[model samples]
Target chain A: MEFPKHLKYSREHEWVKVEGNVAQVGITDYAQSELGDVVYVELPEVGTDVEANNTFGVVESVKAVSDLFAPVTGSIAEVNPQLEEEPELVNSDPYEDGWMIKIEMNDPSELNDLLDVDEYKTFVEEESK
Target chain B: MAEPGDALRRTSLYETHVAAGAKMVPFAGFEMPVQYTGVIEEHHAVRQAAGLFDVSHMGEFEARGPGAAAFLRRLVTNDVSRLEVGRVMYCTMCREDGGIIDDLTVYRLADERYMAVVNASNIGKDWAWMAARKGAGVEFRDVSSETGLLALQGPRAEAVLAGLLPGGGDLGAIPYYGAQERTWQGKRVLVSRTGYTGEDGFELYCGAPDAPALWEALMARGGGEGLKPCGLGARDTLRTEMKFALYGNDIDEATNPLEAGLGWVVKFQAGEFIGREALLGIKERGLSRKLVGFEMVDRGIPRHGAPILAGGRNAGVVTSGTMSPTLGKAIGIGYVPLTHAAEGCEIAVEIRDKARAARVVETPFYRREKA
Candidate 1:
C-alpha cells in the first residue's frame, strides 16, 4: 500500500519513474502483496514496442497467473535480468531492484493520464473496500 | 454471498486454525484451512520431517449388522471379505459403468462392524447411494460429523507419536497398512499405520472433544524435529508426490477405474458386485486411453486442463500438475493414448499458448525412506 510520491501509477498497479524521455517501469508494492509470492516473471525483450494499456508480460504465483499490462506507450530499452534467478525481488523491492523494464517514452504527454501518490492511494483504498 | 447456515458446518479444529492465522477457505461444505505460515514452507516441512494435518473434514460411515461384509463387498471394488477383524484396505466406489464414485479406505473393526472413510465432498452422495441399496440384514449409519481425524506424517512421525503416549514403546512393529486401537492420555483412539504421503506415519481417530488435546500433545513432543501444522496446501502436494489419485481431479464419474490406472483394486474374481460386469468386460478388452505421469523439461509449470501434445499433435490433457516441492521440478499426470503411455515417452504440454517439452516418467515421482 506504500505509494511513493516520486512515481506515477496506473490503474493496473504498475508504476513508472520518469526521467526525461527514459522511464523505469515496475509493478507497485501493492501489486506484489496482492499477488503473493511471485514464482515466475515473464518479461518482454528489450527494444520491443509496447502500447499503452496492453499486456506486455506475465507474472505467475503459486495460485494463479496474471498479465502485466503496459502503463504507457514506449519502446523497451532494457529488461531486468536478475529476475530470471530471483523473482521474489518483485515482492521484496518492487520499486527498485524489481523494475521490469526501462522504456523510451513515445509520448511524454501520456504521463498526465497516470495517477499521483495521493490519488493512487485513494484508488486502491476504494477498490479494496 | 455468504449464507447464514454456513457457520454450522465447521471442523473440530476450526477455532485453532483461525487462531494460528490460517487462511480459511470453503472446502467440501466446511470451513477448512488452506495454508498456515505459507504453502511452500509447510510443504517443505512435511517433505523433510514431520507434519500434522487436521483431516476431520473427511466423512466416516459405519456399516454394521450380520451382513455388513457381504453388503460392503457388493458396494466397493475391493474384496472386503479378505480383510481381517483389525485391518484396513483401500477401495473405490464405482458406478454401474465402472466409473469411480469415490476412493475410500474400508476398516473392518469386528465381525459385524466396519468403517468406511470417504472424501468430504462425496459424503451426501455416497451416503444416499449406500442407504438406497441397503440389502437384507445390513444397516448403514453416517458418523462423519462426530468423528475427528488427524494425520501425523513424515520420516519422524512414529517417534513423535510414540513419545506422546504412555510407556513410549516402539511402534516399528506396526506394519504398513495396519491399524490398532490404542489409549492416549486415558482416551481410546484408533491409530492407523497409513498415510497419503509416502512416509512412515500414523492417522489417529478419536472423539471430537479429544482432538485438541491430541494435537497439542503431538505438537509439544514433535517441536524439536521441525514438526509443523500443515494445511490442505501441503497435503495436496504431499499426495501428488506419491502419484496418489485424488477423486475429483484424477478420477470421476466420467472416467472409469480401468482408464485411471486403478484396475488392480477391482477384484473381479470375487463374486458379483456393483460395476463388476463392466470392469470385467474392460479387462477382457483393452483401454483406449490410460493415465500417465510426465515431468516438464522446459521452465513452465503444466497445470490441470492444459492440453498435452505428442509428436506435435494434440494427444491428451493434464489432469493434475504442480511444481513438486520434493523433486524441485514440474510434474504432472495426464491421460494419453494407450500406445504412448510407456515410461520415457516424450510429450509436450501447451501452457499459455506455448508448448513446453516434457517426458513421461515412471511414478511415483518421490519415495520416502524405509523405516
Candidate 2:
C-alpha cells in the first residue's frame, strides 16, 4: 500500500515517473496486488501513439483480464523487453523492472490532472473499502 | 455481485476461509473464497502436490425405494441400472428437447438408494425437475442443507487422505468413481474417488455440522504435505485445463451434450432415459456446431463471450478461457461450426475487436501422468 512519493498516479492505478520529456510508466504495486499472478502483458509496440485514459495494453491474471490504461498521452519510445517472457515481474517488481513503457509526452501539462502520491493513496483506500 | 440488500449464503468453512486471509467473492449465491495465497499458486499446488477445496455449496439429493435405480436412469441420460453399490457414474440430466439441465454424478449409496451431486446454482431448479418426474415407486430426499462437501485433489491426494484415516486400511480399495461409507470423529462420512481437476483425488461428504472439524483435521494433516486451501478462482483454471464443462459457462439450458463434446455420457443402448429421443435425433442429423479446444497462436488472451472467428467472419463464441498456470499459455473452449472444429483447423478469436490467430487443438489442455 506504499505509494512512492516521486511517482504520479491515476485513479485507474497506473503510475508515471517523468524525467524531462520522457515519462516511464507501469502499474502501481497496489494494482499488481489486486490482480494476482499476472501471466500475460500485451503492450503497444515502440513508436505507437497512445492517448490519455485510453487502454494501451491488457494485463491478464490467471482468473481475470484487465486493461492497462494510459495515464498520460504520449508516443511509445520503448517497451519492457522482459515482460514478454516474464510477465510475473509485474507482480514481483511492479515499480522497477515491471515498468511497462516510456512515453514521449505529447502534452506534459496533462500531468496536472493526475494524482500525487498522497491523493492516490486516499483513492486506493476509498476504492478498496 | 449482489444488490445492496441481498444477502449471500455462507458455507460452514466461511469463518476458516476468512481467518486464513482468503479473498472472498460471490459465487453461486454463496460468499465463497476466490483465492487464498493466489490463484496461480494454488493451481500449481494442486498439480504438483495437493489442494483442498470447500465444495460445500454443491447440492446432494437421495432417491430411495424399489426400482430407484430404474427411476434414476430415466431422469438422466446415462444408464444407472448397471451401477453397483458404492459405484458412481457421471451424466447429464437433459430436458425433453436435449437441452442440458445439469451435469451430475450419481452414487449408488445402497441397494435401493442412489444419490446425485449437482451444481449449487441449480439446486432448486434441479430439485423441481427431479420431483416433477418422480414415478410411483420412488421417494426422494434433499440432503443438501444437511450435507457438506470437500474435495481434496492432486497427485498426493491419496497420501494426504490416508494420513487422516488412522488405521482405516489402504485407500486404494476405493477405485476411481468409487465411494465408501466411513467416519470422521465418529460421524458418518462418505468418501468418493472423483474430482473435476485432471488428477487423482477424493471428495468427502459429511454432516454439515462436522465440516469445520473435518476441514481443520485435513489442514493439520496436509499442511506439511504442501496442501493449499484452494478457491473458486483456482478451481476454474484447474477445471478449464481439464476441459471439464462448467454448468453455467460451458453447458447450460440452451446447450446439449451431443454438441458440447459430452456425447459419450449420452448412452441410449442400456434403456430409455430422458432426452434419449432428442439426443438420438441430434446424432442422426449430425451436430451443426461442436465444442472444441483452442489455443492462441498470437499474444492476446481469449475470454468468455469473445467471438470465434473463422474465415474472417463470426462463427461461434468462447465459453471459457484462461492463461493456463500449468502449461503457461492461453487456452479456451468454444463452440464452432462443425466445418471448423477439426484438430489443426484454423480459427481466430476476436480479442479487443481484433482477430487473433488461433487453432483447434486436442483436449484436455493438461493431464496428469498416471501413477
Best-matching candidate per TM-score: 2
For candidate 2, the per-residue lDDT at A17 reads 96
Model 2: runs farther than 4 Å from truth?
A: B1-5
Find the candidate with the highest DockQ and give its number: 2
- Model 1 regions more than 4 Å off: A1-5, A28-36, A109-129, B1-8
**Clash count, candidate 1:** 0
Candidate 2 clashes between residue pairs 3 or more apart in a chain or in different chains:
none
**Per-residue lDDT for B140-241 in model 2, tens only?**
999998899999999988889889885743688899999998766778889999998988999999998899899989899998899989999999999999
Where does candidate 2 chain A have its weakest 10-residue lDDT segment?
Answer: A1-10
After best superposition, candidate 1 residue B267: deviation in angstroms? 1.4
Scored on chain A only, each candidate's TM-score is: 0.97, 0.98
lDDT of 1 by residue, A1-129 (tens): 577899999999999999889878999998887766677788888889999999989887665688998888999999999987788799889999998988898998998999999999999999877
Query: Residue A50 in model 1: shift from native, Å?
Result: 3.1
lDDT of 1 by residue, B169-282 (tens): 346656677788888868988888988988878899999888888888888899998899988877887888788998788888888888888887888888878999998888
Tell me the fnat of candidate 2. Answer: 0.79
List TM-scores of chain B, every candidate: 0.96, 0.98
